[model samples]
Target: GHFRDNREIAEIMADVQSTLLDLREIKSNDKEIMYLSDQVQNANTLFLQCINKLNALPKPADEGTMFVGSMLDGFFGNFLGSYHRGLDAEAKQNALNVELQSAIAAVDQLEAALLLLPKVAEKYSATLSDSTGRIVVDFNESWGYSGPNDWLVLQNRGETLKDCTILVQLTGASGKVRKNVHFLETWPSNSSMWGRYQSGEEVLGRTVEKTTVTQVQELDITIYSPQFATQIQYVYQGAEKDKDIAQICKDLSFQGAYQPYESGVIWDTQRGAQITLNGVSYIPKCRVDVAFRKGEQSKGWHWNHDSWMKGETKSFNTPKGGLTFDPDRVDFEVSFPNTNYKYKSTLTVDLKSGK
Candidate 1:
């Protein structure tokens, strides 16, 4: 009976191993699982054979309580039966560990591949039109333009737009509507597009470089040619920290409206903006309010803080630090002209099925 009981237990362990095939299907990192699965099946077979040997023992020995194997040969003995199922169990658990480790390794490999690409464009073949009042260059719907800096993306976009003349379009007060200002010429194939943007204060024939694109809105990149409808991505140009809006405004301290942004009473600048609390913490499940204000510490927070459902805040805890882009808090929801451009706009960040 002891041997039979052990055999049943071994069979149960085998079933657990069989389920590993399904585990392997869901996760490729189940090498250990596969190994343990094979081991358990083998152990079950061995244990079954042992059970049969004990089952075949003489019945006279089984009848004896202690030692009275009568005139006939008899054997009622303690079993070295297949009672040890623990070894196989430990191996099965180890398999799960191997599976999980492999999963994490695979994710790391993918991230490495993405990180190895060219960070910025090597060169550019930009052509501006002279007929237009102001040649406003907007990279609409481009990849790598998710946010501001680090915007130069190479998408392999746009139809083969021909008959494009090359020139420089200077922006003016009328939201790029004035074609009065222009710089004539084409940037050759080997032209330095990146160097031009990063070189902050280079004298272009004494035509100072004022508009260093510190932030990128979006990228609408295209590789125009015979491969017209191919996969060309937009690479929005990025500006350095010194050129970033909040920092630039700090340096300039200029007051007034800039083109493209309708500056009002307060110049909705991001200077002195900060996040109060961040990091991994248990946020209580309740009516959470996210507020932003345009005043000192003693002053109250901005009105009408955005509220998120209790379920919404749960996922935020799983990230590395429970936050992203917390330090560089710059969102151009409203335009800041200056202290004189007093256009106060408070922006808040949170998780929602929102825009």
Candidate 2:
């Protein structure tokens, strides 16, 4: 009877269960997939803990003593199947949350891979060397991307590699070069090819010995990671479209900056200073100036040294930028145009360096 009469506890249990189940539909706002995954696991543990506490509650003491007591006890014991379905609801909620989290992670990864596709394509360039019967195949870098549903497709216009038989050589990261042959005689439009290579697993098993070519675009090659494009351009100038791809990746992957410091030469009271701003994306053109004054002057401190204020560094940390730097008995100030950070330091005479 007492258990059946506890309306507040019953309502609280119902609310928690509802909330736990609702997590399945709510999307995670966290940007990091791994962090969100950990959060879901912890939430599941908490849900189980709450359910166990409710399940541990004792039933009415003297339920079998009276008819009304026995009936009420049965009703209380089976209230929303609380006692019968131990951990089942919580388990289902956890599974649902996990499934949702996995889906979110998969989508995020695929989007990232898609964003990098253009850059990867730019690195696939081909050109003919002056040497007779030899084609120079150059690669900016070799990269790989993987997902659940992964496959490579090569799209070519019937004219890109028409009737060109040439040896394909791939230079790996360790400078080991592997060679293969690609013969394009009357290439078809929108066809596929699979082949086996004698060296470098990166190019082998991608196409058959003889397959028709599919002309989709001027140069549309959708290759899986670890595989690269080896077609050549018939022009004279070196490829420059994807030249900044490597730098872009570095800029994107930068996590944070380190402690900023000033460096340069310090002789007696005269100091020549430069800020070697230490950061993951530090560029040489960034504007970093050291302002200092001798003794106390009304004009205040003056700009002593400034780095690439008009060059490429001006765009750094903006659409554009670290390094570590230098001084004695002087007041110093560091200024960054892109950000709202200001740094000032005082140098004593003992800190002077000749070099």
Candidate 3:
């Protein structure tokens, strides 16, 4: 029974290994890949435990004599007798069989779950048109845009998006409305075609001058894709402080620090304070809000009106009036504007100002 059980377990392991190899080839996001890999590890661990128990079973005494006696019994009336030497060995073997069965069931369930994971697109392309019915904007696999038009394109890199409804607002060089609330749709794993609106026509059927595409000053785009919705927590790994500013603040006195520079003031705009934030987003078109605070006094910069791309890093500096004193903390907040998904992180600063 032990030999047969060991052989069956070996076969099950081989099957599971093949399935894991297939899983690595599937195109999915980082989160889904991690989840599937964990399931495979759990199944492999269970198989190892079952093999260890099978090998630890006691061997039968006098195997040759026992085999001969068992053969004679099999030919006679005692064919169904126990194969092991004692009741204890029989009980242990029974328990091992139960455990082996459970391991096999786990592998089966893992394979079933693998079949249910969705196949997501690896990349996408977007094409936009101007009022002249010409393709004025083209975005390729790298999400880079090329054309004579002035526009902002926000691309979703790794996240899965389906049936996306995009709202775009275009402004001319005079900061007047060239276009507003133009709706566009994007299909799954396919390129998007936009700019179906007629020239000089607004969403409310108002008429405006047909402005030149290249004279566009600002472009705002917002996307609503229910299928691409997922909660993401943007982690604040840390902040990189400016070395020059740090050295200046080290020997400065917090009291009477308001004096002008070259007149004995320690910190000022000439010796500005700045910190570059390191962040990586898995999704695109996010809004970033950064604030630097020292007690009740705080300064903030909002990027809610702009688009923050995936895997992009943003840097912040001290307000127009540079930091006269060391900041106690800095806060970073990111969210998808017009959506409920939001994430916030705070960093406590130790400026080592020697004050």
Q: For candidate 3, lDDT tens digit of each residue in 1-355? A: 0011112434444544554444445433456655756765676576466546645654333343121112111000111111232234556546545654554455445433433332211122132322222112321111111222222223344334543434444554466653222112333333333332223212112322222232333445444444443212211111111221222223322111111122236644422223232332233455667666777887666664254433344444445455455556767675542234455666666556421
Mark the regions of model 2 whose C-alpha exceeds 4 Å error after superposition: 1-140, 143-155, 159-166, 170-178, 183-187, 190-244, 247-355
lDDT of 2 by residue, 88-159 (tens): 355543443343334334323322322332232233323322322222222222111111111122334333
CA shift at 355, candidate 3, in angstroms? 15
TM-score of every model?
A: 0.18, 0.20, 0.23
Candidate 3 lDDT:
0.37
Top model by lDDT, which number? 3
RMSD list, candidates in order: 28.4, 24.3, 26.0
TM-score of model 1 (CA atoms): 0.18
Clashes of 1: 23
RMSD versus native structure for model 3: 26.0
What is each predicted model's overall lDDT from 0 to 1? Answer: 0.25, 0.29, 0.37
List the pairs of residues colliding in candidate 3: none
